[model samples]
Each structure stands twice: as C-alpha cells, then as structure tokens.
Target: MHKPLLTTDFLDRARRHYADEEAVLAVDGTRYTYAELGERADRFSAALQARGIEKGDRVAVLDPNTHYHLEAAYGAMQVGAVHTPLNYRLTPDDFSYMLSDAGVDAIYADAEYAANVEAIRDEVPTETFLTNDADAVEGDWESFDAALDDADPDAYERPEMDEDEVITINYTSGTTGDPKGVCRTHRAETLHAYLISIHQEITDDDVYLWTLPMFHVNGWGHIYAITGAGARHVCTRGVDVAETFDRIRGEDISYFCAAPTVLNMLGDHHAEHGGATTGDNDVRVATAGAAPPEATIRTVEEEFGWELKHVYGATETGPLITTSDAKRHFDEGADDRFAVKKTQGIGYLGTEVRVVDEDGEDVAADGETIGEIVVRGNQVMDRYWNKPEATEEAFSERLEGYYHMGDLAVVDEDGFVSIQDRKKDIIISGGENISSIELEDTLFEHDVVSDVAVIPAPDERWGETPKAFVVPESGDPDDAGATPEELKAFVRDRVADYKTPGEVEFVAELPTTATGKIQKYELREREWDEEDRMVGEG
Candidate 1:
C-alpha cells in the first residue's frame, strides 16, 4: 500500500529508527540525539498550537545556521503551518516588507537577530513573536526556550497532511525589487531532499558541517536530507576559518556545501597554515553560486586533497538540479578532473534540464550556442505565493511546461552545461554580445585583481560598452596601479578585442547578495541610471 510523503516522515523515521544516534551538534557545542531533537521539535509544535497558531498559518523564522533554525522549521511544518525563513543579512525595512508580504502571523527569531525584527515590530503584521533569547529583545515577547521547556512533546495532535500542499514560502533574494515568495509543496521539498542524498552520496557514515546558511533554501534542503539519512549535523553560527578547520578535524566532518568564495577562503587559509591539516579525513565539498576558476579547482583538489563537486540551481528549481561530479571515464588525469569539476554537469536523476533558444527549440550541443536553461522536475516549485502573473511568466508558455531559469548557458556534446551569464547581465556593445562571466573569469586570472563585476556603460559610439568595477589584490583598491589601461591590456590579450572592457572603476568590493552572488543589477543600474533605458536597447 502506498502512503502520502510528508516531511514529518523524515523526523518520524529518524526518531523511531535512529533514536540513539547523535543528530545535531549545535553551534554552542551541545549535542542532541535524534529522539531528543524530535521531542524538542514536538514541544515547539505544541507550544505554537497553545499560542493559537492554527494550521495554514504563516510562521516566520529568522536566524543564522543554528539548532534553533532547524527546530523552528520542523516545528512549524509539523502543525501544518507554512514556514517562512527570513534572511538575517537583510535590513529591518526588508524584513518589514517580507513579513507584510507573506502575511506572516507569527515569528520565531534567534536572540542575536531579534533586534532587527524588534525595530519594525509595531509596523509588522505578526501578532506573536518568540525570541530564542527573550532577554535579547525589548518589549514583550515569548521565549522560544521557555515555551519548549514548559510544553509537553506528546500533548498535541498532528493535522492530516496533504503532501502537495504548500509547506514553505521561500522568498527570492531581491536584488532589484521586493522579493517574491516561492511557495513549495511538501512533496517538492521531500523529493529535493532525497535527490540531494542520492547525488551527494549522503549516508549515515557521513558527518555534515553547517557552512551553508539554513535560511537559504532550508540550507539547500540538507536539514531534512541529512536527518533522513541519520547523518550528524555540526551546526555553526557563522563561517570562521579557524573554527571550520577545527570542526573538520575535531568533529571528523566528511561533507559540506559552500559557495566558491568560501572555498577560496578555505584554500587560502590552508595554504597559509602549511596546507590542509585534516590528516587522513576524506572531506568532500559541494560548491555553487559561481563556478570556481580552473586554477581554483586545481588547487582545491591538488593542495587540499578534498574532492570538489559543483552543483547549480535556483530557489525555484528545488535549488538543486545539476551536479558536477568527476566521472572516471571523462577524467584521465588531475588536469582533466579539474576541468570537469568546473562545468555544471548534467541534470540530477529525475530532473529535466534543457537549454532552449527563443523559439523554444533545443539548442545544439556544440558548447558554443547560447540558450536559456529550462527545468522540469518533481522538485520544481508549483507556483509563487499569490502571484499568478509572475508564476505564469516564470513558467512561460514559450517552454510549455518547463520553468525558465533566466540564466543563459551552453551545453557540451557530453551534456555538461556551463553558464554564460544571467539573462540581464549580458553586455551588448556595437551589435556584439559579451558575457560578463567570461570577462570576470579572465580577470580572475590576473594576479592583482581580487573581485570584479562587469556591466554595460553608456557609450555614444557603441550604444553600450563593457565597464568593469574591480577590487584589486593589494594596497588601496582605489590605487592608480589598478589602472584601466593595465586591466584593459590584460583582457585584450586573452579575449576578442570587442570583449575588452572600455573602462575600469576600482572599488573595495562588488555589491553582492548574502549568498556571495555578485549583484550585477546594482552596478548596471548605477551605470545606466541616466540613460533612457536602464538595460541595453540592443
């Protein structure tokens, strides 16, 4: 007989089968078994119900990666409430907008970030506020710890669940305008978590490190996936080089996921500290957001001896659809393996990833033809929360049933996909198309360039020309040595003359989202603020 697939099954299975297993190593150095964690989640759920949080209510949780974040999600979903996680990096105004937009009825915030919510408490529509540390916030609010401590775990009844019902309303990282909530069904999240386990080789033997934030797509759905697999989760408040290295050695961490920037930091730290000190521990890293350069991949594999796997997706597509695991037949040597790791490999097992032209025809696998990436799978989000127009646009009729990724990519003969640039970040100059990612990758090869963002600047001759905002590797970022002419020569020698940036503006850093994705839209807005059209007319 078949049964419904609810997220609670993950927690229930763990509590029943892996009750004695260590489930969470909290950021504060506390450990809890699966049974204990399940009980805590149950108590939190009971407490929410006691506070009048009925089924279908929208509850928001704001915190960094912590045990509290995990519990909040599990607890909120347990009682049939839709969980909405707030990005801690955002401002109070952003929080106010999101709380109001999602119609969040209740909030559970970590003590450290309670102040952010407190700042706009009066303006927000939420009636209930629970802080992890009640003393940390001003005014009256429920204490998360106290509520759970006082509640009975077995006192409440779980509502009958429909697997296809929306359980989470994850908001997009609003780089341009207000963020939109992507309503995800319980079925989608469960399937995504299962796919993560299958692709990442997650097993009970694996120990996971919390380098990725739990708020970002529920830590890319690792919270449930890791628990379902009975793996140990080492929670961390933040990413610290020293602490991360310590956990790798101390906790025997075998797996983690991070953006390329974090991986680069780890690589730099290892090199500075006389190379990786993990001894014989076999650590594997999954990186995304931006593809690491070929050199970075080589150093990560050769110097650190840790396997690097690259995966790609967005918040709408289960946030995971492609993985770049090195295949034995395709990899003949270290160099070949590094090259393979740089490309965002084929679709995951049950995912359908396609690159199509404007006409909705599949592009040739020549690796040169650029097309938009579209996805259709079990994990793809059903729709945006209360935004039918946007949902229709996202799942455009041009592709019939697939969701448009808004990312332009090229697929190789072997079906490996490499991203060119976001649809809006592409530069058009004098009837020529230029990929900003291509320029950024080339600039990354320069010894003195640290970070760079390429945008289209208004030009009388070329309609629009490429302009670079650069962060140098040494001295003052505004130093004249990071000269426009010098950087122009650097690009001219490597790529076509048209691809060379016309001007270089040095800055301390590029504007980025909390996830370390460069906000090219901000730069483009500034450059074309005065133009009749913000984006290139071409």
Candidate 2:
C-alpha cells in the first residue's frame, strides 16, 4: 500500500536512510553530514521564526546555489513558508515588480547580489533581510549566519501541508511576453522529485554536482529528489568550464544535470583542452532545452563518455514529465537511435502527454506530424497567479482536466515527443509562420557567428521581419568585433533570402535569463515598440 506522502516525512525518512552518509559536499571542500544537515535546516527554521516569519508567509531568496541557500530552502519548507527564489542577476526594477507581485515578506540573498534587492527593499513588502556576507550587505540588511548562530539546532514542527497547497511560486523571467508566476504544490514537487529519484537513479550513494540553479523549477526538481534520496550535494555559485571540470574531479561527482548550452560549453572546453573519458570522472549529463543538436548529443557521448540523458518539460509542468529513456528506443538501428533521441522522449509514470491539432483532436504519432503538446497530470501548476483567463484557456473542457502547454510538438510510434516550432516566435513575413529557431539553427552552421538570437523586427509591408543579434567569437583574443554585413552575408547564403535577417545588430552578448534561455521579450520590446501588434505573441 502507498504510504502518506509529506515533505517533512521525506526529510525524516532520508535522514534515517543516510544517517552516517555525507548528504552535502561543497565545491570548497566542505561537507555536511545528513544528521548535521537536519540540524542546520532546523536552525534556519528557528532563525526565520525569530525574525517573525510565519507559516505560509512568502520568503523570497536571491542567491546562487550554495550550502547555506539549500538550508534556507528546507528551513522555509519546514515552516510551511512559500519559497520564492529570485534570480539575483535581475535588476532592481525586475526585483521591484516581482517582490510586489509575490507579496514577499522576508528575503535572503548572497553578498554578490544583496545590493540589487537593497535598492528596492523599501518599496517591497520584504521586512527581514539576511545577506550571507554581512560586510557586503546594504540597505539595512543583516547577517545570515548571525540568525542561525545563536538559534538551537532543533527540528521545527512541520505544519500540516495539503497536497494542493502552494510550496513554491517560481516566477518565469518572461523571455517572450509578460512573466507569469507558476504555483507548484507539495504533491506535484514531491511526485516529480520521486520521478527523478527513481528514473535518474539517485540514491545515498550518488553525489550530485549542483550545476543548475535552485531558482529554476527547484533545480529542475532535483533539489528535492537529491535531498529526498539522501544523495550528496556539492555546491558552487558559478559555472566556469575549468572549475566545473575540477569540481567534478575534485568532488568525485557522479551525476549532474545541465542545459544543452552547458554541455556545449563543456564539449568546447574539452576540445580546447583534453579531458577524461569512460571513468567515474566521466559524468552522466541530463540535458534539456532546445534538445542538444544531434551533433552535440553524439559528441558528448562519444568524446567525453558522458551518459547523455535527454528530457524535456516546461516551468509550468513541474519540469520532468518527458524523457527519452525507454530501452527499446535505444536498442534499435543507428537511424532509429538518432530518431528516438530527437523526440522529447516519453511521459513519466503518472504524467500524460498528448499532441493535438488545431481542432483539439489527437494528432498522429508518425513522428513527422506536428501539433501542440498538452499535458494533464499531478505535475500541472494550480494556475497562473492573478491571471484566471489565461488559466481557464490553458485547461480545457475537452481534455476536461488537462493543462494546455503552449508548445507545439510531435511523437513517434515508439512514444518519443519532439518539439517542432514554438506557437509564437514564429515570424510572419508576407503571411508565413516562419520559424525563427529554424533560421537561427541554420545560421549557427556559419563559423563567423559565435552565438545568435533570432527575433521578429517590425516591418511596414510584411508586419514582421527576421532580425539577428550576432556575437562574433573572440578570435584574436584582443580584438572584439563582427561586422553586421559579414553576419548578414553569412546567413543569406545558407537560408532563404526572406528568412535572412532584415537587420543585423552586432553585440558582445545577447541578454539571457538565469536558465540561459534567450530573453526574446527584451529584443521584441526594441523591435515592436512602434508596431500596433506584439511580436512575441501569436
């Protein structure tokens, strides 16, 4: 029989499971025993309580992945406080909007980022402030360690949490349009964590390199699973390719989850300087987002001996609903292997995924057909905060119960899901839903371009035109540049003339979110300010 599922219950069980085991290992050679972790978490709970934080009160944290940050998260969870982790890299203006929207009452931040929140603290609801480094804190922020220093290392009595109660109010950075708050429940988080622990094979024996930020779907729901499974967590604040390599070797890290970009960075780093293959140091990389290009997937596996596990999900879907891990799919011919790897994979145990056409009828799973992918499961968000109309439209009377993911995709007969084109981000020039990603992917084949973000620029005749933001790779090490004409000519020769960017802007970097997703909305704002229509929305 299934037992009672509870957040604190998982904590208790994990504590027993890994009693003598080291539950966390930091990059700087620090370790926290499972028993010690429980104490630190409890101390954090007391610290928050002393600061007047109460159950269900929203506590916002703005810190990168660190051991203390993990303690703060579990502490907030223990008190039933809603954990709202903010991206520290966000400007004061962004913090202002998010803090006001979430009604955050208390905050914890790192030394590097305390100032951003400090600039807007007076205007925000945040009262108690804790910055890990006191000397770096400004605007009445106090020391973080001070609170926990004097507090007793005792377990906080966990409040009764219903399955549907909101545990996290994760804010999307709004890469396309207005940012929406995703309210994930205890049940959804627990189950998704359970899915990762089981599917990813996380256990006490496993040591995790905390590469992904905790703010992102709770580190793609690995924080809970890693902690729930009593696995060791090695903390670090940045993702330096060299540092990542050293930490993997230094921490003896066995498992890590990374975006396709990170995998690409590692692959490039390895190409520049040789590294290990087929050893404990040869880690398993769980890649998501943009489905690591076929070449990327192959290179990572063959060169580094990385066990590449491809999976896909969104912020609203509790992040780990589909994975390409079915054994039969991989056991086929080489063409079939590549074909299976291309899909977003199959649904998790309790998750249901469907591809529906324009009329909402289920689409064929021939792998060639494309349709919008919608999901119905325990992992679905409760609703978009303060946006009932969008929420209603997202859930259908036809599915009768499913949540509609705005993504368009297709599936193979073997049940692997493949993302096609985004419903929006589709460029319309003379009435064609031109895929900007397709054009951008094609343009990436050019050697001159280091990185690119494709956006729809305003046009008088066609309503929109493709615009390219190109960053030239530093070739000379001292010289910085890419001529717009060079970028334009490079893309023109490869793609259709119309798809070639009407305007090319040379920049050092394109703006991106914490998760490394290109902030297309920022680019769209500059492109569509004068236009009557919005470029990002369909």
Candidate 3:
C-alpha cells in the first residue's frame, strides 16, 4: 500500500512519536510540547471550521518568525484549507491586492501587522480576522489563543486530500509586476521537505533558530522538515545580531537558515564586539538569496567555526532545489573547497538543474558560457494562482516543462552552477556584458565597504555604465574611510576595466526586502527614471 504523501503526515508523525517532547520554544520563552502544539493546531482547525472556513478556502497568515505561524499553517493544512502566507513587511496596498486576489476567506495577522490588513479590510473578501494579540490591534480581530481555548479540539474533520491537490500558495515579491501566487501541491511540498531534511541534515536533537522569515516558502520548507524530524524550533521576532548570538549559545542552536545579508550583519558584529559566536553545539548555517562573496563564506567558516551550506532556488521552485553541501567535492585544498562551496553545488537527489541557451539546448559546461538556469523536479510549483497567462509564460519561457529561474548563470564541468546576475541586473556597457554580481563581489573585498549594489546608470557615451552604491562600514556616508576615486581604482586593479564602476556613491544603508535580499530594481529605477527606455531593452 502507498501513502498519499500529504503535508499533514509530518505533524501527525511528530504527534505520534514525539508527542511528549519539546516541540517549539516561542519567541517569548514559552515552551510547548509536541502534544500541546498538536492540540493547539487541532483547536485552530476547529475554530476555523466553526467560523465557516471550508476545505479549499484560502487562509492567509501574516506574522514574523513565531510559533503562531507554524500553528496557523499546520491548522489550515490539517483541515485541507490552503495555507497562504503573507510577507509581513508588505504595505497595506500590497496586502490588499494579495488578499483580494486569493479571495482569502479568513486571515491570522500578527497584532503588529494586522493594522495593514485592517486598513484594507473593506476591500477584501475576507470575513474572519484573527490576531495573536487582539488587545494591541485596532480592529475587531479575535485573539488566536481565545479562539483555540473556545474551540472543541475534536469538532473539526480532516477532508480526504490527494497528493496533487494544491495545498499552499506562495506569492512572489512582485518586483516587476503584481505579485503572482505560486501554487504548490501536497506532494510538491512533502517532497521538498524531504529533500531539505536530507540535504540540511536535520535530526531529532537539532535546534533550528528561526532567523529566516517563516513566510518565505514556509521557511524554505523547514516548518515541515524540522517538525517531521521531531526537532526543536527556537522562534524569534526577527534577526537581531546580538539576540541571535545569545540564542545560539543559550539554546545550543545546531542549524538555521539566513540570507547572505544577515550573515554579513553577524560578521560585522563579531568584528566590532568580540565574543563567542557559537556554544557547545556545532553550528550549520544555510545561506541563499544571493551568492555570498567568498570573503563572507570564509569568515563564516573560519571565524565563526560554523559549516556554511549555500543553497539556490526561487519561490516558484521548492525554494531549495540545490545545495553546496557536497562533501565529496571538498577533498581538494582549502581554496578549492571555498571555490566549490561558492558555487551553487549539484542539485538535490531528484532535482534536475541545467543551464540552457535561448533555444532550450544545454549550454557548454566550460564555466564561462552564460545561460539561463532552468529546473524540473517534484517540488516545483504547479502553476500561478488565477493567472493562467503568467503561468504559461513562466513555464514556457526558454524551455517547455522546466521552470525558468530568471537568473543567468554558468555551469562547471562538475555540474556546479554559479549565478552571475539577474537577467535585468546585467550591465551592458559599450556592447560588453558586465555582471553586477561580479562587480559587487570585487567591491566586498575592500575594507571600508560594508555592503554594495551595482546598477546600470545611463551614460551618453556608453548607453549605460556600471554605478555602485556602497554602504560604508562606519554607518555614516559622510565619514566613509575611502573616497570614490580610491574605490574606483581599487576595483580597476581587481577586475577588467570595463567591469569597474564608472561612478561610486556612499550610502548609509541599502534597501533590502523582508527576507534580506537587496532590492536592486529600486536602484535601477532611480538610475533610469529620466531615460525613455533602459539600455539593451526592446
């Protein structure tokens, strides 16, 4: 006999085997056992049922990295409702568009962010509003704990679900247009969780810190993977460098995921205030969102004494189809190891990652031939929600069945993929292709640069030239230790002359998304606002 491979199986298994074990450490220091967590989820399911939420209805969750997000997500999935997570950093207008687009029936927004939802409550189709702290919110939102307390845990029924049923909808960042909901099935999520469990090396004794947003692809599927493994979830409000170190040493955190920017924050903090970055537990950190500079990876591995696993994927994919944890490739020298780890290593067990040209043919594996990265696997999204045209365009871009990642990359002979830049972020100057990632990576090596974003600035002579916005280490642009000409000469000595930034401006900080990825499009918009059309565009 075969199982249906539903996402609910994860929590069910944990409840059956590890019910008495500590399941989650809430942000406020409250600890809940698996049995307690499971009951809370069951109560949430009952409450949703009582509130007229049915199977297939969309239930949105808006919260930081907290236990409530896990409970709300599992509760909705337990009763066969679609779990739709919203980015807490989004504006009220963004929430309005997503909630209205998804036709969300009910929503659980954290008290801090519920006001955004409340601001647009009149425009959405949602009826039930729930918040973790109703007293702090300004609307008629019910307290989540109160709902669970009043609910009869056994009153809800679990509907029969198929493996192919779309159980979750994740929204893209909408940098180009309106955010599209990426539809994923039970089988897709279940398989993705399994893959991460294998690659991330999660175990029952591991303590996972929630530094990454739980809304990001369901914490990159760790919400299910960690729970299914019967591990511990140490919740947090967000990434606070000092608080993160305290948690690592206090709770003995074994594994966690963070964007490269968060890692940089930790590195910077360690440099300023020297202290123990790890405790008795051996730490492993998974980083993505961008290819971290080799310097960042070296700092993480050498100074912090932590294992760094660089992963790559998108919201449309499992958000984790590839990992750089291939130990077999690390048998070479230390420099070779960092070189291998710097690239997005081989695909997961069942994932097929390839670099293909415009015609869908495989690009040469010479490590210099650039092409688009496409993938096909069990964890890829089925389609976009309510947007058939966008769905068709995504899957049929350069290849038919594979999901286009929209990142241009090169593949090595050993199959390691190195992302050069986003398709639109590539700088075209004097008919030469310049990768902004390459330029930024070069700049990151300078002592005075804390962070950098390179964009195509319009030029009368070259059509468009590379311009870098640098965040100084001093946190004050005016006090930046290095001058623009000095930084320009620094890059000129490191890379090709054409790849060097023609102009450099110091900034106090760079704009980042909720997940800590740099918003390069904002920089591009500012640079090309006066131009009729961007260079190299049709």
Candidate 4:
C-alpha cells in the first residue's frame, strides 16, 4: 500500500477529479480547465522529448506569472526533467551564469524576457531556445506554441519518477553575490504543498490570485497546493494595486500570498478608493518577508474585512514553516488581536521550530531573549545544488540536525515567534546589539514613511551606529519631506534611544531584490565604500 510520494500526483489528482473545473485564468483573459491544462502539459512534454531533452536534464523557464509558466513546469517535471525557474528581472549576465551553472539543456522564455536570453545565447551551453510568443522567434529559436501544436498529447509518457529526485532548482535573488540554486526534491515539495493547504485552509471552491511570482519557490509551493485542492488560479502579469482590487472584486478571489510591502500598497490604495466591495467573498491573505505593522493589520481586518495570516520561512526550508494564526491567541480586544496577528505565530504541522543561542540550547520563552530561528521538518531542503561545503556549513553551526534560519527572533510564552532582524542586518553600537528590523518597524508607524531600511554606519565614537534611510510618501527628498530631527524625536518616545538611528538619510527608494526584499547589504556597501573596515575594535 506504500507508494513513493511525487509532485506530479497533485496535478494528476486535479486532472482526475476536477477535469472540467476552471484551473487557470491567465493574464491574457484566457481560461483553461484542468483537463485542458493537462493536455497542454502533455503536448509540451512531447515537444521537449522531440527536442532531445532527456531525463534529469535541466530545463529553464523565464516568465512572469502566466499559464505558460505553470504549463512549462508541469510539462518538464512530468517527463523526469529538472525544472529551473529563472528570475526574469535578472540581467543577461546572471541568466548566462545560471544557465551554465545548472547545465540547462533547454530554455522557454516569455516574449518580454526572451531578449535577455538571446543576448547571452552564445555564452551559455543551452541548446533549445524557445519562445512562448509564436511570432517572436529569432535566429534558430523555435516557437513554443507551434511545437505544442505539432506534438501529440497521447504520445508522451511519464517516466518512473523517484520521489527523492530533484524536481526543481530555485535560485536565490543574490543580494550579496552570485545566486545559489536550492535543489528541491519531489518529496519535499509535495509535503510543503500539503502544509500550505492545511495552514491556509484551502478548498476546492477557493480562488487563488497569483500575486506572488511562480518562480519564487514555485510560488511558495502554492502552485501544487492550490492545484491539488482543485482551486482556481488567476494569473496576473505582475503585482499591481489597481489590478489586484479589480480581480478581488471581479473574480471573487478568496486567497493569495504577498509581502507586507505589497499589502501596504493595496491597503493604501483601498483607503484612497473608498473601500470597494469585495462582494461577499471572504478574502484571506498570507504575508511574509517582514511582519506587517500592527496598524496595517488593523486596517486590513477592520476596513477591508480581510483576514491576515503572517507566516515565516526561508527558501531553504520549503518556505512554509511557521504561521501566525489569530485563533491561537485567545484575544478579543482590537489592540490585543492586532499585536498577536503581527507576530510570526507558531510552527506548522510536523515542523519543529526553536529560537536558540550560540550553544545550541533553546532560549527562554520570556519574549525578550533574541536568538537564531532554527527548524527541522520534512519540508527542509536536502542540500544546496553542487555545494557540499556550503550545505555542510548550513547545517553545521546548530544542534545535530536542525537547519539555521539566520533570522534573529524571540519566542514568547504563547509560542509566538517574532523576528527581530536578519543575522547580518543587526547593528552593533557601543557593544550593544541593535535590531535594524525593530527600528524599521517602529519607523513605519510614521505616516510620512512609505518605506525604510536601517543599516550600521561607521561611528568613530561608538564602533558602529544605526543609520536610517527613509522613503517619504509625498515624494519630497533631502529632508524637505520629513526632517531627521523630527523622525528621531518620533522614535525617542517609542523605543530605547540606543536602538534609535543616530542619522536619518531620506532616499526616494530603498534598493530591493526582485522578490521585494530590502537589500541592506547594498546600503552597507555604499556607507562603507570609503572605509577599509566597517567598525574598529574597542
């Protein structure tokens, strides 16, 4: 009765049970049922075989959140090829490096980004260069649609797949250096999909909006979880506030995932537009990449009548480790509910999460002690692709088996995990540790601050001091927007003065990865460009 777990089973289930149900609502206004989508995948798989793509060969997909992205992923993986989803925002050089590094044999790109691959086609070792746009092919490149048309859906056969085999390799955004590919096995991905479904309470009737990019950890494994539940997937070209509002009302969207920054944009837009009717559709949103401020959570629940679930995890951890659910808090007051919804709640089912110190011992649950968040579960990745030393180091500085999350956090008495900051983003000022995330979160309380990033700046008197870069809502620059002294005074009453930034630099925008994570390293590099080392010894 025991069978190997594979990701393909999810798609198969959708095809079998929900064959005639609407599966995808593409940005181009095309809708496909589960049966139709499966047929397209079959044709794509046959086309890959015709083009000489063999088992275990890497096939790269470069596109936005589109039906083509989903089809390419299911098609490539069904025939035992390893699917690699590239970040379309990356430059041609990055594409070339990743293609060569992964030994990619075939590439399928969207029309908007095919030129990026074309620029580096000669430098990479890839063979088949195909475009989703039938009319956009250039020199030697084939049309993806035409190939799909020529291929027979029934001719392609599924290979005997090993659950332990790597199904997808997702490259990091590489804010610091060249990106590293995180190899995700079929077993891990399947388990992660189940976790997402359980935590998000997905159902067949639920409609999922593709606010998150599919290339990022396969949309945090929602692609499998939603499809497995026989839910509807509405794909958008990209995240847009106006488009999101229209879809939520028009399509009656039930669930979606996005960063806190995106949530803030939507919330701000909703406020400006006078609270459009969601039309009896109970919307639930899952947010990560930083906890939304208590005020943002309050606005979302009170004004829009939407539920906010704050989850936490990294790309290496199958990305669905912990969720902040309001039911566990047992609080009824508005302030108490808002505060509880803001913390990265408790561990997901079958996951063990802890905040531990350098000694590998658990920190006290007093909520004051900060430590690295470590976790272990079926969802954790087996290893980084071709980087044994890096893989070993990732699991080294911890207890025997747990993987370190590199994020500093504190577990409260109720088991609520709140992230203080990333390990590298912490600021050391006069021998006292300061959390830049804490400062950023506190600064977000200011109405004028649309965005903010905090980093350590060289301070002759205090080793290193906290410095703040802020983006004002009014688009004013050079302190004409919000004076540094006014912002400093605002924070002085909220948190410890030591935690407050010594200097505030107003910028139009903060440097961010394509995934919308603030790149503190870039800010640090600029501040320390003139200095040999960041800080001096006492």
- What do the candidate models score in CA lDDT, each in turn? 0.82, 0.75, 0.88, 0.83
**Model 2 off-target regions past 4 Å?**
1-4, 175-177, 277-282, 332-335, 397-400, 426-538
Error of 4 at 26 (Å): 1.2
Per-residue alpha-carbon lDDT of candidate 4 for residues 410-498, written as tens digits (9 for 90 to 100)? 88998888876556665655434466777788899998898999888876555468899999987676644669989999887676566
Candidate order by TM-score, decreasing, is: 3, 1, 4, 2
Off by over 4 Å in 1: 174-176, 426-538
lDDT of 2 by residue, 1-538 (tens): 8554556656676788787788877655778888888888889898888778888899888888888778888889888898888866556766888888888988888888888788877898888888888887656777877888878766355677777788888886333444578888888888888888777777776778887888888888887888878878888886777888877776677888876667667877888988664335447778665555566677876677667778877778887788886767566435456556656788988989888888788889798787888887777788877778767877873355677666677777866777755556756553333567766776678776688888877654444578887776764323435466776787776644666788877677888999998888788877767643353221
Candidate with better lDDT, 1 vs 2? 1
Candidate 1 lDDT over residue span 438-493, tens digit each: 77888989888888888888765455678988888864676645578888999887
Per-candidate clashes, comma-separated? 0, 1, 0, 0
Better of 2 and 3 by TM-score: 3
Candidate 4 has an lDDT of 0.83
Error of 1 at 241 (Å): 1.1
User: What is the TM-score of each predicted model, taking all chains together?
Assistant: 0.81, 0.79, 0.81, 0.80
Q: Give the least accurate 10-residue stretch of model 1, judged by summed lDDT.
A: 529-538
